[model samples]
Target: METELNVYLSEVTDDGLELSGTLDDSIYGFEDEFLKPFAGLRYELGVLHVGSELLVRGKIEQDFEAACSRCGEDFDFTVKIPDFTASFAVDEKTEFVELTTELRECILLTLPTYPVCREDCPGIEKKEEKAPDSRWDALDDLKKG
Candidate 1:
């Protein structure tokens, strides 16, 4: 679902525009199992018209939850994604697509490669060693013969 940026764009009296909106799970797809049980995303977009170019700036803040790589336990983490800015030539066809792609890319880039349950989680426990087979013992005796 596309969150409406029309309000901000419509109010562009000057060359620069400031846009802010609250984004819940409904629009951002946070209800998926991987993204649930975490905080919501809040974002702001700023657009400026410089000459024939449109400069876009965006910021996002949210929390994420994921299973730890080693312990298989769940963990909650927060990511304050850095603001992103890009320039694009204002055109009929490419403006919206470029902005949407840039937003998705920025969010994905901010995510951690691997999330841990805790800093000190001892990994999956090692299993106990098994005793040597009786067949092996018999084979040893035969070899000694």
Candidate 2:
């Protein structure tokens, strides 16, 4: 299901609002990179309207796909970020607050710099070892003489 990232201030209440759903693919994506979300992000969040600030606390889970740093193979990665929290100042006159960018930043920051296909990936194979050339043997004999 498509999750809307806009939370209207009018809909928020002092008692807090519960948010649980999968974020839309269009909301978070890469332009020309392999690193992307395999499945939309799932969030179980609590949105509280506290005086002048919006306090957001929740858990976010997501499946991601990225090319392996060593082998360049595609692999799946899972992110289960717990205790995710964000606070935004309430603009008294604003009608809505957009969370798409903020949430995207949060998730992207949790990704690894170098992703791997597997824990024990051997990576690229090394070139085969070569035997010592016979020309070197002649030099060794000359040195011995």
Candidate 3:
């Protein structure tokens, strides 16, 4: 889902900009056999005029369901991501590109590589032990002799 940023950008002033929005599951694409749809997201974006540059700051909060990597239990997990970046739009012609890249990178970095259902989840059960090979026993006897 392409989130609308115009509202937030329009509010930008000498002081800063304040933006609020709801992010649905569509934007995140958080799909796993174990994870269910994430709840709606709440976020704020603030843009400030620094000494000679523009600074972007944002915070997002959302909840998602995750399954234990080892076990198969499911649990709810909350993610709150806070990020900031400085842009030199006055001096750099590619300030828009840099800002976009920074935001994307921050979002990716905030996500977890592995979301476990619980910290103490027990992994899958082990299979029953099998009997030792007869050949190994014979080899042992030969060595003893």
Candidate 4:
């Protein structure tokens, strides 16, 4: 599955591997309807090989488009997944591990619950409150008669 991870760990480089690259993929599967990964995924990671398991920690950056929770307006956002980390145990026979799912999940977990376009977003404006229209006065007068 090295094709998915886009990085292969050699049998001899078991001590650790340092990698940095850009991942171009349409990442989806988030519970939030407004948030989506529009820009490419960029990362710089350190992988520590311990036995059959790999311990990974690094930074991930991506651009996103999210709808404002109050006004439903789309806004561009940048997500910085600093210290993004994951661990995996690969089969001894496996050549390389795939990290597509792990990377996608790391970004999804960092999505804002209620995304706002701006700190001072007024949202949808409310209609002005007013007294009853004068046209209803005639009906009230008729009822009194």
Candidate 5:
């Protein structure tokens, strides 16, 4: 279903409005080199126009390309929010409600703080043990004697 980032208050009915669509990747306009949006956000929301307030509830899904924090390997990540919800205060003058920014933040806030490529990732390579110092060789010789 095609959907816009904003909801027109006039379209709302007593039975509420159901919105389902994929918000374009442009919605995430902020700059972050590390995290790249893989695809547009898919959402299914229910909008209710109550007294002095507009309530929005639905599910949101987004895909992202992220690097593993432990190994620095690139990976795909999917964030799903089944109970996504928000509310806004409105009045007679409120013509439309902006949904892009809030939805973007919601997905970002749900992202993993330290993402990993996999659970079994071993991380960076470990260095081998060093050979004994020559100074300690003399002590070993004395012990042998």
Candidate 6:
């Protein structure tokens, strides 16, 4: 349920239209226990109409609460696209260009496949193996005899 991101052709000016806003977390429609949205998606973009193409370029950022892949601990995470850019095909009769799907995909693609709390996060601690049972010593004696 991504929020509609449409730029009307008439809105594009010679200096390019500047669009900046924050969309609800529902825009992602991400339903995962391990990865949860912590904040809304924020975008600052410039829209331009060039020939038969609509160009959208700018920055996109979103915050999340993700579980560490190795430690299974929850941590804050942020997905940022500093140089987000996309071009859509349009025509003289086209009214507006939709950028919701493209923006969603871009954010999703930027997310880490295996998120970690930190770069040097030590994984789950491993327990030391216990010493062998003394009861096995009798069996060892029987075998020696």
- Scored by lDDT, the top model is 5
Kindly list the per-residue Cα lDDT of model 6 for residues 49-130, writing each as its tens digit: 8888888999999899999988888999889999999999999899998888888889899889999988887777732456
lDDT of 2 by residue, 81-138 (tens): 8888988888788687777677778888888888888878877653234676888998
- lDDT of candidate 6 at residue 83, scale 0 to 100: 99
Order of the predicted models by lDDT, top scorer first: 5, 6, 2, 4, 1, 3
Compose the digit string of candidate 5's lDDT tens values, residues 1-145: 2335899999999999999889877677754566788668999999999999999999999998888888787888899999999999999999999998889899999999888888888776632456768999899999999
Report the lDDT of model 1 for residue 89.
Answer: 68
What are the TM-scores, per candidate, against the unseen true structure? 0.62, 0.77, 0.60, 0.71, 0.80, 0.82
- Candidate 4 clashes between residue pairs 3 or more apart in a chain or in different chains: none
- Residue 52 lDDT, candidate 4, scale 0-100: 77
CA lDDT scores, all candidates in order: 0.60, 0.80, 0.60, 0.75, 0.87, 0.86
Evaluated at residue 8, the lDDT of candidate 6 is 91
How well does model 2 score by local distance difference test?
0.80
Model 4 lDDT, full chain set:
0.75
What is the C-alpha lDDT profile of model 1 across 74-102, one tens digit per residue? Answer: 67877776667777765534334235445
TM-score (C-alpha) between model 3 and the true structure: 0.60
lDDT of 5 at 50: 97
Among residues 3 or more apart in sequence or in different chains, the pairs in candidate 2 whose N, CA or C atoms overlap within 3 Å are none
| Per-model C-alpha RMSD | 9.5, 7.4, 9.7, 8.5, 7.1, 7.9
Question: Whole-model lDDT, candidate 1?
Answer: 0.60
lDDT of 1 at 60: 69
Per-residue lDDT for 1-145 in model 4, tens only?
0224544657327567887776764545443567777657788899888777777889988788889887788898888988998888766676777777788788777878888988877776632356779999999999999
Query: For this target, which candidate reaches the highest TM-score against the unseen true structure?
Result: 6
Point out the higher-scoring one by lDDT: 1 or 2. Answer: 2
